[model samples]
Target: MLLYTESKEARRDVVRKEHDIIMLIGDSLHDFAAEFKNKESTEYQRGLVAKEAAHFGNDWIVMPNASYGSWSKSELKMWNEKAEK
Candidate 1:
């Protein structure tokens, strides 16, 4: 397994280049199309990344860390509950 870290801004650059699998970690995918919701970029780079990943015939997994990555709010709630107990 390999891990690659990239910012949302940077992903716009090479998303359509070429790759076997494009696993977008965190809650970014939830808003993948949000960026171009009102924009004129019909390419839908985010979707393209996902599509390309699938077309490449490789397995892609978007595993976000519950404790730190995208579930910080829920994790905090759980922590507070534990403390209250």
Candidate 2:
């Protein structure tokens, strides 16, 4: 059996061992594949998503994320900043 490091795709080694077609379902892009795990920049990652628009909902399904998401890297502030301290 081939190890994940030995495989080209970022899929798990166990998944790689299978011969059947695989469909990925996840809340994050990286959960689907490493190509979506680009470390360059968020813009670049979005660009990649645009490039693979056709594959979305067809090949891999992205589930909804209920909690705080990974897309927002900005410094967070209190939702309600009070006035007249």
Candidate 3:
């Protein structure tokens, strides 16, 4: 199941709907998920979600994007190196 909410409270509310598991998947799951390259907001947003999930006693998973994701800077550099080779 998928539930989209704009605020943290809303996200928690959705989790209360009684689902087997909740998975938050997206590019901007957190501020850093989208702004990781900015250096100013590189902290993982998944951590925030994880904390919230714990507080709500909800089962959740945060799936990260590798190609163009928050952690893509290193992967991008590797890909660029291969392209150069």
What TM-score, computed on C-alpha atoms, does each candidate reach? 0.25, 0.61, 0.28
Off by over 4 Å in 2: 1-11, 74-85
Candidate 3 lDDT tens digits, 13-85: 5666775334444444442223223344333544555546562323334455555755554323443666777
Local error of candidate 2 at residue 62 (angstroms): 0.8
Candidate 2 similarity to native, TM-score: 0.61
In candidate 3, which residue pairs get closer than 3 Å at backbone N, Cα or C atoms, i.e. clash? none
Candidate 1 error regions (>4 Å): 1-6, 15-60, 74-85
**Of 1 and 2, the candidate ranking higher by lDDT:** 2
> What are the runs in model 3 whose C-alpha is more than 4 Å off?
1-28, 31-40, 44-50, 53-58, 74-85
Ranking by lDDT: 2, 3, 1
State each model's C-alpha RMSD to the native: 10.9, 7.4, 8.4
Which 10-residue window of candidate 3 scores lowest in summed lDDT?
31-40
Candidate 1 lDDT (Cα, 0 to 1): 0.43
